[model samples]
Every structure is written in structure tokens, then in C-alpha cells.
Target: MNLIKRLAGLLAVAASCSAVAAPLLSEGFNDVAALPADGWAFINNSSPPGSTGWFQGNPAFFAAADGPAGSYVAANFNNAAFGGAVSNWLLTPELLLVNGESLNFSLRLLGEGLLDRVEVYVSSAGASTNVGADFSLLAAFESPAGTGWLDRRLALSGLAAPASGRYAFRYVVDDTSLNGNYVGIDSVSVNAIPEPGTVALVFLGALALVAPRRLRQSRGLWLLAGGLAAGTAAAQAGPDGLMRFPHVQVVSQPAAPAAPGPGGFMAYKDPVTGQLTGPNPEQAALLTAAARAPTPLLRQTPPAPRPAHGGISLMLDERQARYAVVRKAPDGSVHESCEPAPGGLK
Candidate 1:
């Protein structure tokens, strides 16, 4: 039981580890330089653009997801003057989208809060700065509810295709100074989901390939069992066993006329159980030579006996006088037949 549990634990660990697919793109805004180095763009299309756009993080509001205080990126309502619209866009570099991709990031509202809104969008393929022509909204939500950080994950497969595209985070506020607040984005990751778990299907496919082999083996086994049950000289262990072909078997009987023995017995070697013993005991009358053979040696049923036409008789299979009759016709022709035995075929 302990070994099984340990094996199960190991498989679970492997699946969990395998499930983490390598990221197509990852960004941890450790410093402001990371923006220009990775071709990230900061576009402020605010109506009558304001003074502030994207800027460095400040620990006074909230710490970074990984590094020190100022190791993140932030956007605020200052892009537009008080009571004016703020449309600040933080766009990612162009990426090849082959479908079925995902992204996750941590975000938080900094400083005094408002019911601010941030929206995510994607371009058709390679729309560099034409935010108007190609970009389509992917998601939108109010700022994180608390002062602490919030994690968000999104599936891009539905919106993306086998082309190139860009991701953009748009921070919009109707009134700059009233409902606007600071929002920080950190630890962004884009990855593909992994695929596994094919061994069981492969195993069932293999079984389909071996079905014919099993059928052939069963036929040989049946022939072997039949010979062993009959206690015949044809016994042998092989793929074909004894029934490779049919041949006649002979069971000799003693010629006798005393009160016939009651036991169904034959001279052939019985099985290891020694079940072929005769009807007469040592102190009782001796057994007749025509006593019936054991049930295993029988081949047919019993029929009504008829008088020998020319005083000649014969026997067939292991049936005795009680089970069958044999005689010679007047023209010197021999015939043998049988019907249901005394009790039953057994």
C-alpha cells in the first residue's frame, strides 16, 4: 500500500510539472529600461493629451511582485488634465499568435482609489501604432478592489489567429482628477497549455493488434483439453495438440457370459484419481469381460439389440451390450449402431 501511494504521488508531481508550458513571452518590469529594450510602447491618445504617461513604480503605494519597490510599471490619470478624458495605452511588442495561448499578470490600484476602469485589447495581426484601425477590445474591468495586488488570467485563443498581433492595456477615466487613480502592472506572462496522457490509448490500441494471436492459442488449448479428458494415447502438449487430425480409437472388451458386471469400466489407464476400477470385488463374483467402459471412453448412444444373422458379432467404441448391439447380416456384412446409453451419456 505504501509503495502504491508513493508511485501515485510521483505521477502526480510529474503531471503538475509537465502542465507548466514554457512561456512564449514573459516580462517583469524590474526597471524602466525594460520598456524600450523590449520594444514596448507608451501611447497617450487622451483628448488634448496631458503631461504624464507611463512611469516608474513607487513603493509608497505598493511593492513590486518580485524585486524592490520601484521595479514595476505604472499609469495614472495625469495623462489628461482634471475633468478631461484619460486614454493611456501600454502596448506590448508584436508576437506571433498561433492560437491557444494564455497570459497572466498581477495588478493593483495605487494611491487614493476610484472606480477606475482598465481595458485590454488585441490588434488584427501587426498593427504597430494604429490603435484606431486594427485593435479590438478583449476584456475590461474596474481596478482591483483592495490595496493588495490582484492576479488576472486571460485566454487569447478565441481572439487570436495564426498571425502576428499585439496586446495593449488601456487605462481610461472620464474625469481625470475625480474618478481616476494609479494602476501598476507587474509579472506578465504568456504561455501555451501542455498536452499529455496518451499511454492508455496506446495500450488499448496494442490489444487490438493481438486479438488474432489469442484466438489461435485458444483453439490449440481446446484440442489439448479434449485429448486429456479422453485418456487416449494421442496426448501431447503442443500448439496443435492431439486433434491435429481425426483418427479412429479402439477400446477392447473381454468376451464373457456370466452375470455381467454392473460397473462401467475399461482396461485403459484411468486418470490420476483411479476411477476406472471394476464392478466385482475380491470376495464377490468375478466381473464379465463385456462390462461397459468408463464414461470418458464412450463415443455414442445405445440402440435396441438385434439377433446376429449368421452367429457373428462385433463391438464399436466403448458401448457394451447394455448401451449398443452389434451383429453380422446373412450376406456376411457387419453392422453396428447405438442409441442413448443406459442412464445417460455420462
Candidate 2:
């Protein structure tokens, strides 16, 4: 009975641990030179054109006044050389947002420029490029000049959550007066919110762990708790009944060709098309023999233009283009044709 209670306690703990949601996306701009890569895009929409748009790695653009000495993406309109009006956008990669997910990032502002405004937009219909057409504003604010770095967190539940497709964050800055003040952003992240059901299950599991020993001893209670735990565990397993971890899979290179066959020819099967290619004399002889067999001959469609050297060429027949083979005759006349090329062709 004590062992049973311990087992239940362990199960409850495991259930609770597994209920925590994982981060969907995280990015920290430690290397300014590597910016705008890995799906991050920057666009300049300023009209009358000479505005110096967003710039990264500028020593002036730091996340915090006295914090880490690293780079952050920044936009400034105050000292614009091509000054008339400035509109710039920094976009994040497509991100998947669920009902209870949230977005967070760190921002820093410098100078007393009140004319500059920063707005954050989100889109589900398409890329968050257009302001009024595709993306809807999520939040907007004027950077309070001299405010060092500030952490911002926004709840995304029920906001532009689509069944499929992507969500992009469009950060826009507009300065009609060329205030020259700077707005910097860093350490952006998106995280999922654990579902209520998961929380309830975790709570129930915890409660089961603290139940009176007498209650734990009851066979019915044990069966009920065990069944629930099993169901939860099964739900988390992949289709093949194995636990699934979210991680990138590395594709391995193709395997080397098979050893030479008895006829000194090597064969390899295409992983994608499932077609087999071989230089085996035995297989070639068999194909040649089969071509000479007394099978009824049918008219073959003219072959398509030959491909460039080392390129794939398809040969079609009246019925269909099933296979392609290059045949060499006793007289050294080489012919390429579709599968089962008419039994005899001089």
C-alpha cells in the first residue's frame, strides 16, 4: 500500500511537470551583424527617399543603460538626412500563435522626441506588411524619451488566432517631424499558455498524492487515478506510441551505393522516386533478353528531346512512360527507349 501511494505521487509529479508549456520562438539580438537573417526582414517605405532607415550594431543602440553590452535593432528619425517623412518596418518570421499564447520583448528609447511613434501589428490573413489592409495594430505608443530598456508583454489570446497559416509581428516607426529619437528592441519571445484542462489534471494529480492513506488504499480510487494517468500519458505520445520531443531533425546524406553485384555493377535506389538504377551486367542482360522475348510488339511514341549531359531524360510510349533504359546491341548500336521497347527493333 505504501509503494502504491509512492507510485501515485510520482505519477502526479510527472503529470504536473509535463503540463508546462514550451516557448514557441525566442530571439536575442546578440550579434547585430547577423540581423535580418533567419527569417527576419526589414523594409523601408519612406517616401521622398533619403531617410536612413533601421540600423543595427550601432554602439548607441544598446538594450539597457548599464546592462549587457550587446547589439539591438534600432530606428531613429531625428537626424534623417533625406528628411521629409519616415516609415520603416522590422518584421519577424512567421510564428504560430495559439489562443493562450503571448509575446514579449525588451525595448529601449532615447532622446526627447515626441513626434516619433512606434506601433506593433499582427496578421493572420497574410504577411503583416500592409497597415490597413493585411495587418491589424496590436499596440501603439510613443517611446518615453530617456526610458532605458523596458520589458513588454502582450497577451495574444483570441486575437487573430487562425486555424492554419502564420502570424508575423510588424514593428513600424513613423516620424513626420524627424525627431531623431531612437527606439530599440531586443530579446523577443513567444510562449504558449498551458491549457486549463492540463492545469486541472495537474491539480487532481497533486490532490491524489496528498489523499489520506486509507483513501489511497481503496482499490477503486487507485484504479481511477491510474486510469487518468495512463490516459494523459497516452495522449502525449506520438502516433507510433513514442514520446515526442519538438526539435529539428537533421537529414542524413544518402547512403553509399551497394557493393558491386556478381556482374561487377553497382545499384542504387532513389530515396525520393523509389526508382532503381544499376550498371549490373546481369540486369542489363536480363533486360536485353526480355526486350528480345516473343511478347507482342506495340508502337512506341517518339522520344522527347534529349536532356543535357548527366541530366534525366524521360522516354514515353503509346501507353505511358513507365521506365527508361539505354540498350546496347551486339552491333554496338546504342538505343534509349521507354520500358519494354518493342521486342525487336533493328
Candidate 3:
């Protein structure tokens, strides 16, 4: 059956059975097939004025895990700008909302030099205002903290719940302008904590699904009872929690453009840290402008003439002297070009 039909069948089954809701919401990089417009905004010590961000790629660049892991949107970090102060680079993704649900999410940031910290900021969407607790993933002077695939799982339980569709995330690299480093993040997913009773029933039901057939029906009933109770209680919890129940399936996705064709001077991830080494925005712009400048060609002009003299034979054939000696008279003139003079003895 087609995917939609299969989905409908699954929904029908879910309606009949007591559903144990899944805990996560994942926004895959390729979900839109193309990168989201304004999904990411970047800044670097090297960005040219008026450019969006100095991310690498012809049209756009994307982030992905080669295998097993998933993919996500990633911005390029130009490390060259951190001439000496410190090797650092920072990037922030669009906001997220737990919408009042507690959160368990995984974040990864790996790059060259030192990745000082990956801080989570809770703020009103579009407003520069901080909402609740500002969380930190790393402390200052933390070297190799998030370097080389540091997998961090965060649980944000007590922060004020976010309203739907409005939240913020920011990553700060210590001494970014001084340090040349970049970060790669993948597979960000949110896990919503289920209520206590709902959790118990989910476990029990899950056990039965794997157990012998005889226990399955009883567990199924228990699962249904728990779901109905949870659903009923959720109605009181208002739209906040109830609405969060569905496994947020991103319905439509765009395919990522094919990997870039083979080319020269590609950036590489640092062995210690997965950070990329590349020209920053400023350097790139300077190079671009220089390449487009017009060049001027020039020709040399001959020197001016000196004054003419009385027939020192002004244009005399100098080569003639080599064959036969020619002597000039006391006057400035040559004696009508004579042959070699005889020696007095001869």
C-alpha cells in the first residue's frame, strides 16, 4: 500500500488500541528536501558586509552523519579570523518549544581548538528577551569538552514551559574571533516525559507485546485503560499536554542536494575536534574582489634623439670600420671613407 494508506491503517489501529505515545520529536535536516529558509543564521569574524553568513557551498551547505546517525542543518565556521586571540566559532539554530513538556534532548558540538561551551537559551521567539533558565552545556576553559563527538543528553525539567512554536537556541564559542574552530551538530530530538501512571502502563504494555500470546490481551487492556485515563486527564491538562501527544511526524521533506562534486582545497574536520579549517568570510570577500578587479597593460616608448653633428657621418655605417679602417680628418668630417693607411715604414 502507499505510505498514506499505510498511515491511515496505522491510525485506525492506534484508535482501537491504547496507544503508548512515543517521547521524541525530531527535525531531520532533509525533512524539507531543501534547507529551511532563515532556519539558521550565522555570523563570523570573516563575513562580508550585507552577506547572510559565510557558510561554505555554492548555493547552500548542509550537515549530515555519514551512517547510523541522522542529519541536520549546519552552518560553516571560518576559523582563519581568530588570527590569534583564540580559536573559536559560534552558531545558533532557530528556537524550539517544549510547550510546557519537560525535555530530554541530545546535542553534539565537535570542532578544532577549544569549544568553550554550547549554551541553551530560553527566550521569547523574535524578542531578545530571556524567558526562563539559561542552560550551559560547557564551562569556560573546558578543552576537548565537546571535542571529538561529545554526545550530550540534556534534561530540562524545571524551566518554564515554552509556548507553542516560540523558543530559542544559541551556542557560544569562547573567544571565537581569536580561535579558528567550527562545530557540527546532528540528530536533535526532544523527549517529552510521560506522566507517572502513563509510564507504568506503557512499560507493562510493552512487556506484554514481547511476551507470550496469553499475556498480550491482558496487557493490551491495561494499556487501553491507561491511555484512556491519560487521555481523559490530558483533557484537563488543557491543550498544552494533550496536543503534545502525537508523534510529530514531519509530513513533507525535501531531498538534500547531491554531495558537492570533487574539487580543490576542501575544508577538513580537525582530528581532535570535528571543526573545519577554511577561509573566513572576510578573507573570501577580499579574494573575490581582488579576482574581479580590472588589469591594465602597458607599452614602452623609445628615448628622444640627440643633436646631429658635422659628418661624424651622423649615420655612418659603423660595420664598415670593422672591414676597412676609416679615419676622420681634424675637422668633424670623415675623409671620404679611405682604406687602411700604410705604416710610415711600409
Candidate 4:
């Protein structure tokens, strides 16, 4: 009988240890300048071209008391230049959600007498640059004319099991009219919930420890004890004998193409290949004008005569002047190239 009580106490301790929740992902938007870094992506789908887009920063117009001091993601839907129509999306990094997990986030509304709506979504389909059609609606909320933040939690355990082991969150906002207010989001987190089997194990263990000795000797109690122990072991081992949790990896995107140079020279290279591409249409006209302008020389003396093969040399020099390096092929053929420079520029 003493041995039975000791075993039950051991099981109860194990159950309590296994019931502790683990954090999967947490982000506070503390670094405003690097808002969408670490796999986060912001997408703007506003029509008429001039609508404001989502950005990360402290509230500019109306402040929310709960907003952190550092920074928060926000969108200005009421800009007059764009006619108050705003459609934007913020996506989370790819995560792996095991059974019994929950997502929590906070939202705040800025300004007075303006309405804004936000919808949360989860996708198990695949990594997408744009918000595709495949996603499950998690929750939706409309912020009344106010200046405070609200915390929200969603039980993701109820969602269908994912075959791919990858999931993401999408925050969609639409503030078509009455754009005086903005929306802010911060303190996003994903955490694990204790599995049901763990809870059952704890309850059964306590009952076995306190129940009369005659009850423990009953056949039905013995069967229930065996089942609970098996269930607890199965839960602990997981499906493939490995415990899993959602994890976020930081993925950096390629930098955008450089704009036209101040002197109207098109010195940008292709992002994939290091080959120099054509000029921007807006800057191509400027290039033509600059080409026609008279060259200015510090010294008035006539330039030295060029070599007979100077044309190729001049082209090579021009490529070098634009920070492109020349590489020689294995066959000894000189190839002009504009490789990606240090500090993420090409």
C-alpha cells in the first residue's frame, strides 16, 4: 500500500512537469526600423495608387496608452491624398504548430471618431509572398472610435491538423471610410497548451493515491489505471517518439534594385543574375539628355589620342566606373559583371 502511494506521487510530479506550457514565437515590434524583418512581410493592396500603407513606428496622430514606448506596427487609413481606402496585410514568419497551441496578440486603435476593422487568418498551405486564397479565418474585430489597446487570444488547437507542419498568421485591415483612426499591433506570441492526456494523468494519479485500498484492488480501477498510464506515455513520446513545437527562423529578403543615379546613369544590376539591365523608363529620358550635353573638362587641353583597340578598353572602364568588376571566363574571354556588393547592395 505504501508502495502504491509512492508510485502515485511520482506520477503526479511527472504530470505537473509535463503540463508546463512552452513558448513558440514572440515578437513585440520593438525595433521600428526593422519592422518586417525576420520573415515578416507587409503587403499593400490599396487601389487608386495613393493610399497609405502599413508601417512600423510610434503612433503619430492619436496615441494609445497601452502602446509600448519603443515602436508598434501601424497603418494610417485616413490620409486625404488617398481618399481613405486602405487594404493592407501583415504576415508572420513560417511556424510549426504542434497539437494544443494558442496564438495571442494585442491591438490598439488610434485617434477619435474613426472606425477600423482587422481580421486574423492562419494558413497551412505554403510560404507565399502575397496573401493567397488558401487560409482559414481565425478571428475578426472592429475597433470602435477609441484610443486603447486590446489583447486577444485564439485557441489554435481547434484548427485542422496540418500535414505540412508549417503555419503562418495574416493580419488584414480594411479602413475604407472614416479614416481618421489608425490600427496598431504588438506583442504577438504563440504558446503550447497542456495536452488532455497530461491532465487526465494528473487527475488519475491523485485519485489512485487517495482512494481506499479496496478500490485500488478492483478490476475496473486496475483497467482504468493501465489505460491512463498508457495514454500518458503515448502523449509524452509523441507520434514519432519526438516532441515538437513551432519554431520561427529568420529569413532575410534580397534588397530591392537601386534607383537611378543622380547623374541619370542606370547602374543597377539584376537581382538574380549580376548582369546589368536596362534603364528605368522615367530615367531613360534623362540619360538621353545627359548624353547629348557637352562634356565638362577641368583642363582645356585636347585629350590624348586613344589606342586602336581603345573602344573595348573604354567599355571596360565604363563598367568599372559603375562599380562593376570584370571577370575572365575559363576560355580567357573577358566578361563585364556587376556582382552584389558588400552590405547587401548590387
Candidate 1 has a TM-score of 0.49
TM-score: which is higher, 2 or 3? 2
lDDT of 1: 0.58
State residue 28's C-alpha deviation in candidate 3, in Å: 3.3
Better of 3 and 4 by TM-score: 4
Give the lowest summed-lDDT range of ten residues in model 4.
256-265
Q: Estimate each model's TM-score.
A: 0.49, 0.51, 0.36, 0.50
Task: Please identify model 3 stretches exceeding 4 Å from their true place.
Answer: 1-25, 30-33, 38-80, 83-116, 124-142, 159-162, 165-169, 174-178, 193-346
Error of model 4, residue 303, in angstroms: 99
RMSD to the hidden true structure, all candidates: 40.8, 24.0, 20.9, 21.5
- Tens-place lDDT digits, model 2, residues 217-236: 65655675656555554443
Best by lDDT: 1
Model 2 segments more than 4 A misplaced: 1-10, 14-21, 61-67, 78-81, 126-132, 159-178, 198-346
Task: Answer with 2 or 4, whichever has the higher lDDT.
Answer: 4
Superposition error at 228 for model 4 (Å):
6.4
List residue ranges in candidate 4 displaced over 4 A.
Answer: 1-14, 49-52, 59-68, 78-81, 157-160, 163-177, 194-346
lDDT of 3 at 150: 36
Residue lDDT tens for model 4, 11-106? 556555554667777877777457566877666655433445666655555343344564666766633234534446677777766555667777
The reply for model 1, stretches above 4 Å from the true place, is 1-18, 111-113, 143-147, 159-161, 194-346
Residue-level error in angstroms, candidate 1, position 248: 60
lDDT of 3 by residue, 163-246 (tens): 333223333332345432444455555555344444445434544454435554446444544554465334323233433233
Candidate 2, residue 73: how far the Cα is off, in Å: 1.4
Question: Model 3 lDDT vs. the true structure?
Answer: 0.37
